[model samples]
Target: MAGRKKRAGNPSPGPSGGPGAPSPTLLVRGGWILSMAPGGFQGHGDILVREGRIQEIGPDLPRPPGASLLDASGAAVLPGLVQAHLHLCQTLFRGLAEEMELLPWLQTRILPLEAAHDEKSIAASARLALTELLLSGTTAVQTMETVHHTQVVLEVLEEAGVTAVTGGCLIDQGEGTPPSMILPAGRALEAQLSLAREWNGKRSGRVEAALCPRFALSCSEGLLRECAAASREKGLRLHTHAAENKEEIRKVREITGLSDIAFLDGAGILGPATSLAHCVHVSPEDRARLRDRGVHVVTCPSANLKLASGIAPAAEYLDQGINLALGADGAPCNNRLDPWRETRLLSLLQKVLAGPAALPPGKALETATLGGARALGREKEIGALEKGKRADMVVVDLEAPWLGPGGSPETRLVFAAGPAEVRHLVLGGKTVVRDGKFLLWDPAEAAARAREELKKLLSRAKLPS
Candidate 1:
């Protein structure tokens, strides 16, 4: 959720459009708003939107002279969800790595498929993945994009009206298989730095560029250092995968005689600006180090399960005050990008790891919003419903069958709700989704095209659907 401002109480319904809200820009009233703040979700207030920014929010007040008010009598509003770690271009290659470990998967299934990609295939795949993410209620993504597809992916986000930190790949002495056109490490670094200069802050600070090195296995010391220096010098954020598997830890030991976390810490790239995805094998000492240095951890429970990677010690990390967020790594690995689905799985997984009551609902919701915003370094813009933030939000219809038996709206939302219940959606004050349908693009045609492309891809691999 980018922008959601809150006044203490509900604002008065603005000029009524004969009991219906008007088109394009308007005010939203009569809903139980979920501010998604530290005090837990609360809102029986009104949200005032004008020209795409939350203007006012509170209990009963004179509506804007010309604003049309839409009744939200039976809905709950929350900040739009954020995907902390995302890889859309790698989508639809699901199950390609199911039979391999993380390293072999990269060397064989994952990288080879990524290597065989062209623009048409990748773009179509990205579109399909992004649409799935949107439908699943993810409004923003910190995209770990490939070298050549970064710009196009951002364009996809832009056209889709989604918010995100889009990035290009950084590889030095790259390992495993890669496309012939994959950028040379030296060239990739220069281009990535240049790209950071151009796209790090866009969409009124909604979109950003991050420095992404494939992993420590492929990125050299010098390369990692440059990435750090570039991120620091250019003020771009650092995003990477770390300590996810046994092989990765061994590779780091072979290359640097250091553990994954320590190696990154030595590189000076494991601080508040860094967002590391999949820290499953981290030690207790590593946990303390991360907390001390203020590193952000992104837990992708789905991907880990699909790859048989161990679950992250997320509950322990949370207890240690380390900022933890959620990620849908890539569609290929995780298969989908539903923030709520991820949240539910995260809680259940953590509960299994820690205990039955390990993670509660309110905390689970935070990972998708506030925590996610913090991971993207956009805490000020997205996350919670507050004034001076982007008007990004999803309206859950509480009257539906899935929620009709709800005892508590917020609790039911986190535990029971899914795609069928998102009745309305707003982004930057625009109705990108309304009544469970997209207002921005033809999702039907998008899906049809994707199906055809998926067939071609699967046929080439002789893979079964």
Candidate 2:
């Protein structure tokens, strides 16, 4: 992806030419590089990026001819943040479905609103979410879209130039499910297969497809089994929610005579290729199943807390050798797509749940970066500033007075830094955000489009605007 041209007399460093032009080689010089790799953190280092991959990382590297130079003095350079679970389709519904648990939040407001989405609304929602994510230094995600018009979301993701693993929500049966959102098991599987054929490996393998079954309650046993089989056969990732709330867990046990995790396991859905979200209420047996099966767990601390769900045993999960990652969830639930907020919340919540030493700043930052990459099976390609990895990084201006100079870089990043401090975001060797402003498009225009689309969506859903 080529970057927008730098305007005349603008000191901000960016790609040299207009969009669609060849991606310029970039040399990032003189930054405190926190590589997130083993013994990789260094002060006053330079990174060489060419052909969308990191070529070298050391102090005082020679700048290649005609390469764009990003002066990173007094900044902290780190790998781009990765969000393991998100719902970009819900970006336009922020603050619209408050004071509700998971089931009600879905039945009353979220489902109907999602059911009302048209192509235009979906596009608007995607653009708005991508704008917030990119500005917040999130360069990769594992997101799920609503059932219909998922192609529109994939198209928007392509245009935004982010690595993603996404697919439509698969719901074959559930109470209060919108009629339009429901599909037969065969139809849903076929639809996902079709989506994979079209979108998987697109953008040089930046955008891939996953099998998302919504949750155990929303999907049938047959649908879950078929998804598991298909995922194993096709080498696709399986994503879903499990054991998130007490009420939801009770309902699942009462209906299926098993816990949510047990049900999914019986359906052949527990494996390394599967990523389960919100394992807040897992039993010992369930935890064993997850760890034994090598299933990745994504803990959305803000969403679980806001919906009155219990805090997850994140520190315990790490202790048990279960791969753990972080996410902000959807907009209506968390109200923000910022990974920094999630990282901070995860650390504090773990401290409260365990002890002050539980999940320290360095480990918490690793969960947000390396853990997320492992969850998406892209650890070799991203999550570090190593040679031959994709050039996905964020330059954070650490000169802010609020981030007192006493703490370590990891401490400041996990506790003090935020989106405002993210000076530049580079994805695939392209500088999409520079000097705290997006160079691809105007965020104001994206917000304006979301506002108009939200109005139309409310009208269609017959809900109060």
Candidate 3:
């Protein structure tokens, strides 16, 4: 539901495989291509992939010799869903903290568990998160991890072959913070710089670094300003939380004489390079400033409802021309990282809040796909199923009960589809998942490892079994 770009409707030379050998080619045949481009959906479409970029997209493209073929006759081929905001490090803490509000939930359960994490547990958590995301048809994500052992999460992401922009959560202040979780501004900045040096632009630019200041209450004004400056200096994006809870807003106002968005604006952080998550309580002034500054707002509907945080004015945001994307905040709060659930909830809640014409199906789909890419600053590379884009997409099987033969595919996808409908996934021209099964690693084994690591983590944290 945003800007549309013309399709590059031609073949281009692919990345070099070696000195003389040809790059791998894959032909995805006979799917309903939801290009998400200007032309919209195309029936009986064939997508040709070469050297990890989309080489051609049209009907009845002749398959070259020695190319692998994937049949998608009864599927909907579209860009892989992008989750603009997530916490992969907190995936292992699913349901460990329940029925609590934002601040107390963080102080009592999440922060302590995050502080208790060792490298092994953190690695296991990242693996689990990656597995869930891939199986659920999410190919790209922007995630935030806790203060220490952040590199461990990046290592897992790099090995897993998922597209991601991740950062270490910077926490320097705030009452009720664990001593282990607190990091002085200098030390936190040093660690973030180290991570950027090591992991930024890795995996052929599929994974990158972000500057993540935890939130207003957790970081001082000086640290936030430094984060803003560092992001500009390094050409990185800033990720953080803002205006999620009433108590948090009160605390921010008490600390600074302005609201959360106003303080960030004063600190030179409200702009195109920044993405603010869970902006459920932003005022009209805040929204106007966000729209003016071209800042992206990420909505996590399930987490907001679960934490009893207020719903965001998504329709109003769209009307004011502010960019918005959907996210599953974290496993502890969301209990799952499924983008389809987020998409459906994003539309339903908005319609409930502001009449039936609020967020339509196509717009919701756009927010989950292109809007997410725009938030991550990858709108030109990913998001749309057009020629000359990266070959990252998901195939959804429509031969299911919920998605019957009634409405358009977009309507069915937004209002009816779920994880069980995702049949195959292609990332960078590679078949990572086929027939709802991951080709890289066994998800069951990943879950088992996460359980074992959780036991160790809780034991180390002196928590109940």
Candidate 1 lDDT, tens digit per residue, 41-89? 3768788876666777776746666665555667777888888998887
RMSD of 3: 5.6
lDDT of 2 by residue, 1-465 (tens): 111223234444544522333256888878889999878756779999998899999999998888887767777899999999999999999999999999999999999999999999999999999999999999999988899988899888888888888999999999999899999999998998998998787556788889999998899999999999999999999999999999999999999999999999999999999899999999888999999999999999999999999899999999999999999999999989989999999999999989999999989988989999999989999988899999999988777886766888889888988888887788888888876778878899999999999999999999654
Question: Which has the better TM-score: candidate 2, or candidate 3?
Answer: 2
State the local distance difference test value for candidate 1. 0.76
Cα lDDT for residue 430, model 3?
78
| Winning candidate number (lDDT) | 2
Q: Judging by TM-score, tell me the better candidate of 1 and 3.
A: 3
Q: Is candidate 2 or candidate 3 better by lDDT?
A: 2
Clashes of each: 17, 0, 0
- Which residue segments of model 1 deviate by more than 4 Å? 1-25, 39-41, 60-65, 179-184, 202-205, 454-465
Ranking by lDDT: 2, 3, 1
Q: After superposition, how far is residue 399 of candidate 2 from its true place, in Å?
A: 0.9
Compared with the true structure, what per-residue lDDT tens digits does model 3 show for residues 177-215? 889878889899889888898777655678888889999
Q: TM-score per candidate, in order? A: 0.89, 0.96, 0.94
User: Model 3 reaches what TM-score against the true structure?
Assistant: 0.94
